[model samples]
Target: MNGCAAFCSPASTQPALPLTLAHPLAHHSCTMFFKILLLSAAAFSATTTAATTYKASFTQYGSTDTWGSGNCNVASTACGFYTSPGYSAAVSQNEFGVGPGAGAGPACGTCWKLTAQTDSSGNNLSNAGNSIVVQVTNLCPASGNPLCAQKGLTGTNQYGANLNFDLCIDSGASNALFGNSGVGLAVGSAVQVDCNQWSGEVVH
Candidate 1:
């Protein structure tokens, strides 16, 4: 069993016994055991591969693309409103898809990043200044897709429609009092509120 003879002999698979071969028989048993070990390893590898999930979410900062129904104490085309006169840019009536590209962002869609702030009333949540968490699922793939393996989600607005997430906001923050994650999107932290993918399942 220790030397090469046990492995190369033509009678390696059988017992080349004078009466009952010792070394060759032991080698044959070892070969069978090795095959079993290999098969078990293959099975474990296949199981691990089958159990893996390959979906991802991205976070980016954005605002409503267009204004809906609002009269913020600002110019004709602006978004949320700041309680203080300072940081007027922080406030606008526009939706998540319509902000005029804040903080090194795309005017339309370079990266639909998550804004870690909250908004409400078709707008970001006020004062609490938390970002929204929208979870878009599935994101059906298609040829010529502008977004594939991209890093974030984008807001959409063609008409006065609510261009929301593909996946519903399954759950949300509870920063109702301006601390410990607000009820909606956070202002400066990441939230999962955009959808490259979506689920058909809907519930109010």
Candidate 2:
């Protein structure tokens, strides 16, 4: 069948064929096939598109945002340097690149913009939408955090999140993003973004 002729009859002066008259099901079949193709294309696009923003869980740690000692023993985290004056985070084991036992990985020094959305228990937060950018300075060992246990590219935590950011409260990020409610766990979204003018270890 001439698909172009069927779909673009106005482009030509030739009269359109009356497929419905000649073969009752021809036009219907063509329409159905085109619909199927469109649906398949949409599905393929959805699957091929990599996720840039991820649903994530955020927890606060009461530790100094100093450069050195802690999760990453070197002089300033696994990432090797402190961010700005007080903006650092410990990412999940998988995303931290190196395994729990290692000090660094590919994700070290990566910057992420995190926005608080809800509590760890899924309750909507009063301070939802507050956001902050932080650099990955440490690793949230999966062995220590049950929520960080999710592994591999498709791994997800109990909340169906693939990423976890444990913000250093002393860094001021938690206070800014969650106010007094930043003590424990919170739910949010995380997106990798350009480091821009951020002063920190070279972002990977």
Q: Measured by TM-score, how close is model 2 to the native structure?
A: 0.64
Give the TM-scores of the predictions, in the order they appear.
0.22, 0.64
lDDT tens readout by residue for model 2, 84-112: 46477888887887775566788877788
lDDT of 1: 0.29
Candidate 2: which stretches are off by over 4 Å?
A: 1-51, 64-76, 197-204
**lDDT on C-alpha atoms for all candidate structures:** 0.29, 0.72
Please list the residue runs of candidate 1 whose C-alpha ends up more than 4 Å from where it truly belongs after superposition.
Answer: 1-22, 52-204
lDDT of 1 by residue, 24-101 (tens): 666576677678878999999887645211122211122322323232222322222111211111211122333233
> After TM-score superposition, what is the CA distance of residue 142 in candidate 2 from its true location, in Å?
0.9
